[model samples]
Target: MQLDEATLRIVAILFSLLIGGLLLFSWNSNRVNRELLVLGSSFGSAAVGIVLIGIASLGQSVIYLYTGVTLLFFAYGGGWQTMRIFERRPVKPWLAGLGGIFWLALSLIDPEHGPLITALAVAVVPASYTALMGFELWRGRGEYLPSRFALCMVVGLDSVLLVMRGVFIMIAASEAHRWTETQLTMTLSLLIVLVNVAVGYLMLSLIKERLETEQRAQTLIDPLTGLGNRRALHLHAERILRRQATSGQSVCVAIIDLDHFKKINDTFGHFMGDSVLRTFAERATLKLRPVDYLFRVGGEEFLCILQAAEERDAVGVMERIRRSMKSYRIGEGTEARGVTLSAGIASSRRVGYDLEDLTRAADAALYKAKRDGRNRVCVYTGDDTRLAADVEGRAWAEPRPQAGPLSGPQLT
Candidate 1:
C-alpha cells in the first residue's frame, strides 16, 4: 500500500487543531482553577508531533519542541501539587527538568528521528503521572476513590496510545526508510484519537461530579466542629419532627452554650479557644445516642435534637454532655485545664409544641441556666423573659452573648 503525503498532512492538521483548542481552553481554565496541567501537556505533546511530522520544518519544530518541554515541566509541578493533596513527600522537580531537557535533545538532534522520540516522550509523561496516582493508591494515602482511579485509567490509556505510535515508527523504519502505509496509520490514529477523547471526557465527568459532591457536603457541614451546620440541622430536625407527628413518638431538644468562651478566646487566643470548642463538641457528640443529631449553630454554641422514649432521656443526655465538658481539657501545655458547658433541655411535652417552638423553649431554658449559674442545665416550661433579662444584664458575667447562627427563631 502507498502512503499519501496529502492525507497525512490533513490528518496532522486536524489533530493539531484539536490539540490547540484543548490547550487554549486548559490555559484559560488554569487561570481560574489551576490543576489542569495534564490537559495542557496532552495538547503540547500533540502540537509538537504535528510540527515535527506534519509541517516538517526545523524552525517550526524548534518552537513547538520547546512548548512540549515546557509542558512537561508544568506537569511535574502539577504532580508535586498533586502529591501535596495526598500528603505524600514531593519528589524533586528536577526529575521532570531532566526529562524535559532529554526530550528537547531528542527533538533537535535529527528531524528524521522526531516521530520515534515524540512517541516515547508521550508515553513517558503519562506513565509518570499514572505512576504517581498508583503510588498514592498503594500507600493508602489520601482519599483513593473512583476519581483517582479514573485518572489512573486515563494516563494508562495514553501510555498505550504512545506505545502504538512507537510501533508505527518501527514499521516505517523497517519499510526502506518510507512512511508507514497511510491507510493503516489513518485508521489506527482515528481510533486512538476517538478513544482518547472519550476517556478524557469520562475522567473529566467523574472528577467534576466528585468535586460537586464534596462542595455540597461542605455546605451542609460545620467546617470547624465536623457537626451539622444550622442549615443541615434544621432540615434533619424537621424531617424527624414530621416523622414523630405521624408516629406519635416523643422528641426533645437541647441548646448548649459554652460558659465563658470569650474569656478563653481573649485569654488564650482564638486558636486555643477554637481547640476548646472543638474538643467540647467531640466529647458532647460521643455522649449522644446515634438517633440524636448535633448542630453547631455558630461560635461556641451547639444544639442537640433527640428522638427519645421520653423527656427524661433528653434530660439525661444533656446532663451527660455538661458533665463531660466540665472535665474536658483545653489547650496542650502545662496550663492546659478543663472547660465547662451550660445546657438547656426542653421536651415536646414541656413546650407542648412543634420542633421550632421546642427549640425556642430550649433557648429560653438556656438563658435561665446562664442566669442562675454557668455550667448548669435548665428545662423550659413557662415565660422566660425574667430569666433572659437577668442573664442579659450580667454583661461580663456571661460569655458576651455570642449568638448562634440563627439569632431569632425561624420555622423549620
Candidate 2:
C-alpha cells in the first residue's frame, strides 16, 4: 500500500522525535560530553523540521514547507558535524547554517523569478550537504572509528537516494509534487525515515563505544608522561607472559629508578624533576622496540618489559637506555643537568615468576644498583636470594604504586 505525504510526515515526525529523545537522554547522562550535545541537536532539529513539514501538509503556508526542507538539510549537516566532533575534528556551525540560508534565498527569489527556473538550483543545496557528508564518512571510514565503515555505507546510500530524488524532480515535465507523489517517492520517504532512526542508534553506539575506550585509556595511563601506569603494566605483562609461554621466548623485566632524584627536586624544583621524568619516558620508549612496553610504575620509577629471543638482548637494551640517560638533559638553558638512572633487569624463562615476582626481583637488583652507586644497569643473576628475602620480609620495600599518574616528582 502506498502511503500519502501526510502519513509519511507523521511517521517521520514520530521517529525523529523518538531518536531525539534518545539523544537527549544520552546528553542528560553526560552533559559535559559535547559530542552527545551535537547528536541531540541533530535529531532535535530533524524532529522540528518534520513537524513543520507535517503542519504544511495540513494546509499551512508554503514558507513552512520550504523552511522545513531547509531545516532537514541543516539537520543532516549537524550529523556531519557530530561525526567530526567525535573524531576530534573542528566544526563550523556557520557553514551548516548557510545551507538553510541558501534554500531560503532560493525560495524568496522563486516568487520574483520563475519557480521552475529556480527549482533545480534550490535542489542543489541539500544534495550538496548529503554528498559532502557521505564523502567525508566514506573517506574516513577506517581511520579511527570501529563503526566507520558501517556509517560510510549508510550515509553514502542516503546521499545517492537523495540525489536520485532530486534528479527525478528537476527533469520532470509535470508541475510541483508530480514526481514526489509517485510510488517511488513514497517508498523513499518511508525508507529515509526508517534509515534515519537506524542511523541515530548507530551514531549513539559509536559515541558510547568511543567514550568507553577513552575512559579505559585514562584509567591505565599516566597523565604527565603519557605512559602506562602500574596497572597497565601488570595487565599487559600478563598477556605478554601468556604469549611467551607458547613461543618459549625469554621475557625481561626492568625496574628503572632515577639517580639523585631528591637532589634534582631540591636543587631545581619539582617542575624540573617532572621534566626529567618526561624526558626519560620519551627517550626510553624511543630506544626500545615497538613490541616493548614502558610504564611509569611510580613517581620516579619505570617498569619495562622486553620480549626478545634471549635475555642478553634485553640486557643490551637496558644498557643502551642507561648510557643514553647519562647524557640526557632535562632543561635547555641554565637549569639543565645530565640526568642519570639505574635499572635492574630480571628474566622469566617460564611461568614460575609472574609479573609480581619479576618486579620484586628487579626491585631487589635495583636497590643493589642504587647502593653500589647510581647511573648503571644491574642484572639479576639468581644470586640475590638474601636481598630478595629481605625485600620479602619488609612489606614496604617496593616503590609506591602509581596513584593516578604522577602528581609530584619523588624525592628518592
Candidate 3:
C-alpha cells in the first residue's frame, strides 16, 4: 500500500526488461519479423533510461537527467517505428531519431531550464509517440485483428495521461524539483508498468493472430501459380452465391483446362510447365475483372467465377484470355511454342446458384470444348444444346453428350 517513487521506478524497470527479453526471444525464433526486434529494443532502451534516471536522482546531476531523457525519447521513437513496421510501411530511421534529436537540441539551447520545463518536454515525447502509434493502428483498422482495437485504446489512453501529466507539471511548477517524490509520480510509474504489460501482451497477440491468418491463407493458395486453391473456392463460393441471389445477377462458372499441358510438361520439363502455368494465371487475371475469382483446382486445370456476368460476357472474357495465352511464347531459340486454354462456361440463370451444379455444367461444356477442338470457349445450354466459340470468335451450337451423374474432374 505504501509504494515509494524508487520502488515504483524499479518495478517499471523490471517490467520493461522482462517484456523486452520475451520479445527478443520471440524474435530469435523468427528473425524475419523486424517489428519484434524494434519493439524489444524500445523496451530495452526504456529500461536503461529508467536506470540512468535513478542514478541522476541519487547524484542530483543534470547531465545524467538529460541523457536519460534523450534515451527515453529514442525509446518512444522506437515504439512509433514498431507501428510502421507492423503496417508494412517503409522505415524512416531519421524520423525515429527526430524526438531524440529535438530533446538534445532543447538541452543545448536551454541547459538551465527548470524541472517543470524538463518534465513537460519529457512528457511531450511519449505523448506524441503514443498518439502516433494510436493513429497508425487506427489507419490499419480495416484489417481484422481482435487485439488491434484494444491496443489502440490502451495507447490512446496512455497518450492522454501523458499530456495531462505535462499540464499538471506546468500547474505545479514550484514543486517541480520534487516531482519524482510526489504521489502523482508514483501513480504515473505504476501506470507505466501496467501499460507496458498490457501493450506487450496485446502486441504479441496481434502478431500471433496475423501469423495464423497468413498461414491459413497459404493453405488455400496455390504455391506455384499464386491463385486460390480448391479449398479457397469452397470457402469463397458461398459468399459469391449469396451476393448473386440478392442482386439477381447471373454468375458464370468456367472450367478451364490448359490444352496440351501434358505435352508441354513432357517436352519442356516441369520447370517450364510451371512457368506456363504462372503465365496463364497472370494473363487470365489481367483479362478478368477484379470482382471475379480464379482458382487452381487441379493439375493444369483452373476454375473462374465471373460475378454479374452473363453467358456471352463470360465467353468473351474467356476468349480474351484464350487469345492472350495463344500469343505467349513458352520457350526461345527454335524450341519456342505457344500455349492455349479451353474454357467451358455455365450461367447461374440456367445452372442455378449452386456451385456444384454450375461446376458440373461447366465441366460438361469444357468436355465438349476439348472434344470438339482445343483453344475454344463453350457455354452450356439446358438439354443437349451447347454454344461453342471457335478461334475466329464464331459461335455454333453442338449436341451435348448424354447427361450422366456429373462426370469428369469434380470441383470438390
lDDT of 1 by residue, 241-269 (tens): 77776787778788999998998998789
Ranking by lDDT: 3, 2, 1
| lDDT at residue 351 of model 1 (Cα atoms) | 66
Query: CA shift at 192, candidate 2, in angstroms?
Result: 1.2
> 97-153 in candidate 2: lDDT tens per residue?
687777677667765543443345435655676667666666665546677667767
| Candidate 3 lDDT tens digits, 186-205 | 67657866886788778889
Pairs of residues clashing in candidate 3? none
Assess candidate 2 and give its TM-score to the true structure. Answer: 0.74
Q: What is the lDDT of candidate 3?
A: 0.82
* Highest lDDT scorer: 3
lDDT of 3 at 117: 56
Off by over 4 Å in 3: 175-181, 390-412
At residue 74, give the lDDT of candidate 2: 83
lDDT (0 to 1) per candidate: 0.61, 0.71, 0.82
Considering only N, C-alpha and C atoms within 3 Å, which residue pairs clash in candidate 1? none
